[model samples]
Target chain A: SQQGEEDPQALSIQEGENATMNCSYKTSINNLQWYRQNSGRGLVHLILIRSNEREKHSGRLRVTLDTSKKSSSLLITASRAADTASYFCARTSGTYKYIFGTGTRLKVLA
Target chain B: EPEVTQTPSHQVTQMGQEVILRCVPISNHLYFYWYRQILGQKVEFLVSFYNNEISEKSEIFDDQFSVERPDGSNFTLKIRSTKLEDSAMYFCASSEQALLGEKLFFGSGTQLSVL
Candidate 1:
């Protein structure tokens, strides 16, 4: 699968700390999104940033996209135990084919 | 909040057998998609369906795999002859619009194990 790659395949943080993960794709994208998946569960959409937008925020989650570099980063501020899950960055252009990046597995200790 | 729902949370089948994973997307969603993830692997797109026809499919979606929206609400992915490699977590997702940009709401997924 020639998809995207995420850095720090895994991360561990304590509650109240911040966790960040980066994603890079090979193709052009019109929009990108972040998704969270609990262990053995379905993925839930978190946030999305368009190609023109540099940053987007939703509550404690912040996402930044760099079109020039074809990469994006997700930041979870004041991480909590409930925020412990795998995060994936998905990219899509003007087509139905959406590609997902390798995910970052975060373990938040209480 | 509306949610996409998949049936038979888990399935165990023998090789060469046929299996159909079903999903019922949110009533108003217009676009549907199928994705699979092998253990410890990233999610891979299989097929995208809209207006009762396939819009796009990945290389992984070969001849043995087919998708259909039998009625107004049920979408299914059928594997004619299941292979051992087909063992993975198959997820059904739907977006309100395939208008090129929209977030997907995925089902809990059906864990298929081909023995």
Candidate 2:
């Protein structure tokens, strides 16, 4: 079964605007990681937030984890046309398996 | 930077036939994994391996699936008997350590088309 579900199956924004994607999970997780996948390609790890950490940042990527709510969010600041891709949240639960969400397709217009 | 690599970017096979997908994980990484994504669907975890053995697997990983680390650098997933439903993009990933929050390096993936 999938552990996480992402909201807003699709989003479109102009370059320089911020894009926010939300993820909700069912079970207790050790960590949650966000990934981006271009069409016809594999996923690229963007950022990872541990259960113990509330928020983390890397370049334009900001990930926040709220263990109390069993949810996480990924915010891409000043999005660029190159950032357009499918965003997915993967949760690592008690098992080693990392369950992925349905994903959000983000399209940034040039 | 070392990255995961997969072979046969695209493969076409007939149902009931066997197929093998190969991957080479990042150097010095200790953990490896295989995932599949159907068209317009979420990526699904198939299996995770550590220390040359499967550490975990999802229900989608049935008897038809098998993973092996035949050599020091190569990891492979074999489908004993392919089915049309098995057609999807198969991705291989690897992590440097077993930490809970480490990032996974993924390969470009192989598009498996089981006709």
Compared with the true structure, all predictions reach lDDT values of 0.93, 0.92
How large is the C-alpha RMSD of every model relative to the true structure?
Answer: 0.9, 1.1
TM-score of each: 0.98, 0.96
Q: Taking the tens digit of each residue's C-alpha lDDT, what string does model 1 give over B1-115? A: 9999999899999999999999999999999999999895699999999999999999999999999999998999999999999999999999997577788999999999999
TM-score of 1: 0.98
Residue B35, model 2: lDDT of: 97
Q: Best DockQ goes to which candidate?
A: 1
Q: Please report the candidate that would top TM-score against the real structure.
A: 1
- In candidate 1, position B114 carries an lDDT of 100
Residue range B7-107, candidate 2, lDDT tens digits? 99999999999999999999899999999999957999999999989999889899999999999999999999999999999999999998766788899
lDDT of 1 at B110: 97
Give the per-residue lDDT digits (tens) of candidate 2, residues A1-110.
Answer: 45588988999999999999999988888889999999988899888888899999999999999999988999999999999999999988777788899999999999
Query: Each candidate: fraction of true contacts kept?
Result: 0.79, 0.77
